[model samples]
Target: MADQAEKLRDMVDKKKKADKTHKVIAVTSGKGGVGKTNIVVNMAMLLSGIGKKVVVFDADLGLANVDILLGIKTKYSLIDVIKSGKKMSEIMIKVNDNLSIIPAGNGVEDIANINEPSFNKVKDELRSVVKDIDILLVDTGAGISRKVTFFLKSSEDIIVVATPEPTSIADAYAMIKIMFLNYKKENIKIFVNMAKNENEAVSVYENINKICKNFLKKEFKSAGFALYDKKLPLCVREQKAISEIAPDGKFSVSMKKMINNIFKENVKIYDNPVKRFFSSIFGG
Candidate 1:
């Protein structure tokens, strides 16, 4: 009886010490102009609509555009957190009650280049601000460079966006190969965008998986796809999320399915992935 009571007490203590669960999903692509940032903005917007507190991190510092897509003007970025001694919350742009945006800054290089003290400051500030959020959706820059892969490597859930074009598929596979072999990232998920039909999307995913299994001895999880929609471009021109403008459109429908798949999957909850992401940025 005494041993059982002690074990129960220990369990209670651990449960009490456990932190709130938050997911960090990085949305990326292999090449530029693959509609990667658009997907990230729409996904974050949709998730926020369903009561999920979401923060969109524009990790593509050089060409950061989450703000442009959302039609919001931002005066500060992550760089300001380090250089200007700004708090993360101060720089964050609140899109709605549940949604916020953090611009990484246009033309800023890898954030890891900052000094150790500044790095720690940014990490701590980031943790304090994101601790209560439900999801951190990172929009990474395109390609396989160190700048792009840094976020990809740090994230627990990575969504690699691709199109049906042969060039797009080949580049996507290359990106997956690097993540799998170089970083040993097995939890990578694929989302096919600009597909003509569901059949084409499935076929593309199958081809990518076949290549992975045969070559890398690994496969990617499907996070669903978006069909080519004329209205999507129109919405983009108007700087509005398709889900907001055309909730019943094909792109919106496909985005809903993808988000459902992402949430339905059983993902292991880390103590705080946002903290992990910041710490890993500087090898903390």
Candidate 2:
């Protein structure tokens, strides 16, 4: 009786402690090969570089590549959290002093198989797992999948990454459409990655913006863009993040600006949601 009571009390105390902190951000895209995982890994590193405690959760099932990009394979992944039946903390890997990662190991098919009860359990536990971190970044898979929507709706910020291809534009627009159809459009954020210039980026955002504005009767929540930098692909081939590759590079500067904007806009949303909403609506 004493042991059981003590165990119960300890569990409750730990749960309470883990429930106190965490901001969840989901990185998504309509199409693949647009540097989605690359952006995620680098962004997490940048935030950690700026003294924030961040954890990048590789939630992309089957085609997971964040681990490959980082060159740090893990012993366990979210699969273990779902199937090996370990607590969220058990499968985590500390990538840096301020940043940790939870990868997708084998048996990832199980993550998609989670039913209502299991999903509820996972959600409750993941919220607890992230409470200690300042930001919890979830790297979702490319294109539309049931698992993709699941995380997008749950995230505090959903980052839509895409490029300049005609297909990418259509898919990007389709992605925003799907989100608007499924939930409130105000919470979804879009990032145009690998563009040629500010003009090109705006053109891409404008193309998608016009559609969402006219047909959906919704507005984009927030927008930031990354221009094409040759250093990007080269660094990825070396299995290093962009900032690690060239901190002074053009792409790095733009990315940091975008991230800083994200942090600022985060605080601005509550104090000035209307202004931000309009600016995003107008591509300002």
Candidate 3:
């Protein structure tokens, strides 16, 4: 009996250690048209370029376009995986050996409204695939709706992208405030996009961080920034990742710097991130 108990304990320990590979990084914003999805797709491509297994989970129910941005078409998505009971492996679009994308389906169904059984089944399906990836980059919808917040609150690494526009900055603050005041999520990160220069990017982040420090007593980590690149819009129109088409472009360079900075930080990892993410969303 003691030997059997020891074996069971060992099995549990092995499972916990294996589960640590599932790292969820949710990219979100307070308003639309902030280039949040672009950042997520590019980040996934860059991470996979460096030999890291990455999964781009498009959780943006309002605008699920990660598949479109990647120029990949999918017949099934999270909706099929959850509702029709399709296998996750079937719905997942394998972009490359190191990269895969899970479309969340059309921005119609309120994923937050899913019942407990469906939620648990989805969680199980996600767990089956999540164990094989190094990072899961979730592109959440723009805004602070309940669905958006659910993903943000569940993720250990949350990157809120905001352009240098005044409205964008204000909205970014509101999003951070909601996370802090409601969920007590203090380790939020910020990425300034479309800044004119490095100084402008840092200034924008500093201003937002200062405001958060003053009001919410929380200072978000800097996920770095990108300068205004004309090539970005062109790349988007062409439906290709900037990191792929223009690997040496300003956007790609900035993204590499940001990715490196994030990796350098000693961010916390989860024992079972996939399970935790769904459980938190569904109150499991």
The candidate maximizing lDDT is: 3
lDDT tens digits, residues 168-272, model 3?
A: 999999999998898888678999999998899999999999989999877888999988899999988999998888766678778877887987632222225
| TM of each candidate vs. truth | 0.83, 0.82, 0.83
Q: How does candidate 2 score on lDDT?
A: 0.77
Count of backbone clashes, every candidate in sequence: 0, 0, 0
Local error of candidate 2 at residue 32 (angstroms): 1.6
Question: What is the per-residue lDDT of model 2 for residues 168-274, given as tens digits with 9 covering 90 to 100?
Answer: 88888888888879676457777888888889988888787777889888778545888899988888788888777776565676667678788762212212456
Residues 79-190, candidate 1: write the lDDT tens digits: 9887888889999999999999989887676563556576467557767877888889989888897667767877888888889998888999999999889998888999
By the TM-score metric, which is better: model 1 or model 2? 1
Worst 10 residues of 3 by lDDT: 264-273
Predictions: Cα RMSD each: 10.2, 9.1, 10.3
Off by over 4 Å in 3: 1-20, 107-120, 265-284
lDDT of model 2, residue 94: 84
Ranking by lDDT: 3, 1, 2
Error of 2 at 153 (Å): 1.6
